[model samples]
Target: MHTTYLRDLYHLHWPKVILVMLLLSVTVQEAVSQGQGYRRKHLEFYDDKPIHYGILFAMPFTRYAIKHNEQFMTGDTAYSIKSPTKAAFRMGFTVNAFLNERFDLRTTPSVSLYEREVRYSYPSSPEKIDKRESTWIEVPLLVKYKSQRRVNNRMYMIAGITMAIETNVRRGRGGGVGTLDTKSTDFTLDYGVGFEQFFEFFKFAPELRFSHGLGNVFQPSQNSLGKGIGRLSTHTVTLYLNFE
Candidate 1:
C-alpha cells in the first residue's frame, strides 16, 4: 500500500515538474543569448566629421495658393478659378557645417523645372487654362536637428528658408489668350523630417519636406484671366532622396 501510494504521487507531480524545468531552461537560454549577442553599429563615427557633402534628388508636387478679390464673387467673365497640382523634379548638392552633436547648418543649391497652371470657368464657355512654365534656381539655408543614433539609423528635423529665382519663363502655346506673369524672385519657409540609414561605405537619407512661399509670386497684370485674383503664393511638398 505505501509503494502504490508513492507511485501515484510521482505520476501526478512529474508533469508539473517537467513543465517548470522546461520554462526555466528557456528563460535561462534567452538571458544568456542576450548577454552574449552585441550589435555592431554602422558608421560609428560618421557625425564626428566637421563637414560632409551629399547629393540630392527630389520630386516636388507644387500648386499656386491664390487669394481672390471681390471680383471673383461678382465678376462678369470668370466666375471660378482653380490651380491644379503639378509635379516636377530637381537635383542638387548639399554643403553641411556641423556645429555640435545635435545641430548642423546646411545648404543645398538646386534647379527645378515647373509647369504651373490656373484654370478659369466662365458662364458662357468651357474652362480656360493659363499655363506658365519656368525653371527655378533655388538655394536653401537650413538648420538640422538630429536624434541619438541607433545601430544603423538616426532621425532628424530641419527648418530653413529658401531663395529662388525664376528663369526661362514661357507661356504655353495651347494656353489662354493672355498671360499671368509672376515675379522672378521669391522666398519660402521650409521645414521637414528625415531619417538617415547607414551602410558600410556610405549613408542614405530620405526626407519629406514642405515649403510655403513668403512673398507673392503674382505679377499684377490688367488681364481677364487674373482679374479676380489678388495674390498668388507657392506651396510645395517634396520627397528628397539623399546620398553621401
Candidate 2:
C-alpha cells in the first residue's frame, strides 16, 4: 500500500521534476564548456600559459513569494510579514582561480539589495505598514568540479562557505518618519551548481545558489515597534558571467 501511494505521488509530480532536471543539465553543460574554452584560448595568447583569473557576474532568477510560512512563538504575539507575495532581484560578482581544467578555487564576493514591506490591517482602523531596505556584502570560497574539457560544454558543481557582512540594514515608514538604521554582519554556508557556455569573448553561466546564515543580523532585543523580531538571514540565486 505504501509503495503504491509513493508511485502515485511520483506520477503526479514527475513532469515538473523531469523538466527541471533537463533544464539544469543543458545549462550546466554549456557553462562548463565555455569556461574551459576561455581558459585555453586566453592562455595561448599570453605565452602559452594558463590564466588564473575568472570573473563572473551573477543575478537571481527566481521570484519572491509571500513569507506565509510562519515561525510562531507564544501565540499571536510573534512577528511576521502581513503582505501578499512579492518578487525581488539580487546581483553580484565573483572571481575564481583555475587550479586545473576540471577543478578550481573561486572567491565570490557579492552585493545583494532588496526591500521588505510588512503591513497589518485592523478590523475598523487604518492599515499599518513597515518597510525596510537591506544590502549585504558576502564572500565565498568555493571548490568547483566540472566534467572533462570538451568542444561541447560540460556541467559544473560548486560547494563553498560564505562569510557575509551585512553592510547596511535600515527601515522607514511610507512617510519616511519612523526610520531605524542597523549596520550588521554575519556568516553563512553557500552551495550551488551550474553550467557555463563559452563565447568568443565572454562566458555566460546561470547558477542556482543558496546561502544560509549562521548568526543573527539584528542587535539588542528590541525592534522598531518595540516588538521583538530576531534577525533574519538572506537567501539568493545568481546567474554568473565569466571572463578570462
Candidate 3:
C-alpha cells in the first residue's frame, strides 16, 4: 500500500514540473531572438554625402569688456562704471563643405540685432545709464572637428573668426548726457561645442559658442563718457539651433 501511494504522488507532480520548465525555456528563447534582431543604427548613410546646406537661428547675449581710464581713479565725483549684458536675436543660412570624415569647413552669414547698456554711478547723484542699439551683418568662417558618430548622435567642436559690420547705431540722450560712441566694425574669435542628432529626414544640432573681440570697439570723442573709458571690447555668448 505504501509503495502504491508513492507512485501515484510522483505521477501527479512530474507533468506540472515539466510544463513550468518548458514555458521558461520558450520565454528566454523569444527574448534572445528579439535582442538579436534589434538594430541601433539610424541615418546610417547621412555622412556619405560630401556637402550639405542648412539654416540656423541663434540667441546671443552680448556685453562690453570695459577698461577704465585714469580719470576713473583721479576724478572724485565719477565713482564707478559698469556695462551689463543684453540679449539679441540672429538668423542665418549655413554652407558646409566636408573636407573629410572628421573635418568640415563652414560659413554662416547672419543678421543680428542687439542692445547694450553702460551705467555710471556718481557719489552725489543717481546712476546714469547709456543705451546703444546695433543692427549687424555678420559673417563667420569655421572649422569643425567631429567625433565618430554613435548611433544617432555625435559631438563636435568648432573654432573660427567672425566679422561684424554694424549697419545702424542708435542712442538716447538723458540729463544732457550723450550716448556712447562705438566703432562700426568688429572682429571676433569664435569657439564652441555642439551636439548633433540625425533623424530620417534631416540632421539637427544645437551649439553654444563664445565670441571675443580682437579689436577695440570704443570710439573716443570729447564726450565725458567716452573720454573716461579707456578701452571697450565685445564679448558675446550665443546659442544656435541648426537644421540640415
Q: How close is every model to the real structure, measured as TM-score?
A: 0.80, 0.62, 0.80
Q: Which candidate leads the pack in TM-score?
A: 1
Clashes of 1: 0
User: Could you tell me which residue pairs clash in candidate 3?
Assistant: none
Q: Compared with the true structure, what per-residue lDDT tens digits does model 2 show for residues 2-22?
A: 012353354335434543774
Residue 193, candidate 2: how far off, in angstroms?
Answer: 1.2
Let me know the TM-score candidate 3 reaches against the reference structure: 0.80
Kindly list the per-residue Cα lDDT of model 3 for residues 172-243, writing each as its tens digit. 332233677788899999998777877778888877788999999887766677757889999887878899
- Residue 224's lDDT in candidate 3: 73
Off by over 4 Å in 3: 1-40, 170-177
After superposition, the stretches of candidate 1 with alpha carbons farther than 4 Å from their true spots are 1-37, 170-177
Per-residue CA lDDT of model 1 for 1-244, tens digit only, reads: 0022354355335434543554464456446646766766678888889999989998887779888888877763676676766778999999889999899999989999888888877778987888868899999999999988766667789999999987775544224437777788999999987777788888988777889999988776666677788899998878788988
Ten-residue region with minimum lDDT total, candidate 1: 1-10
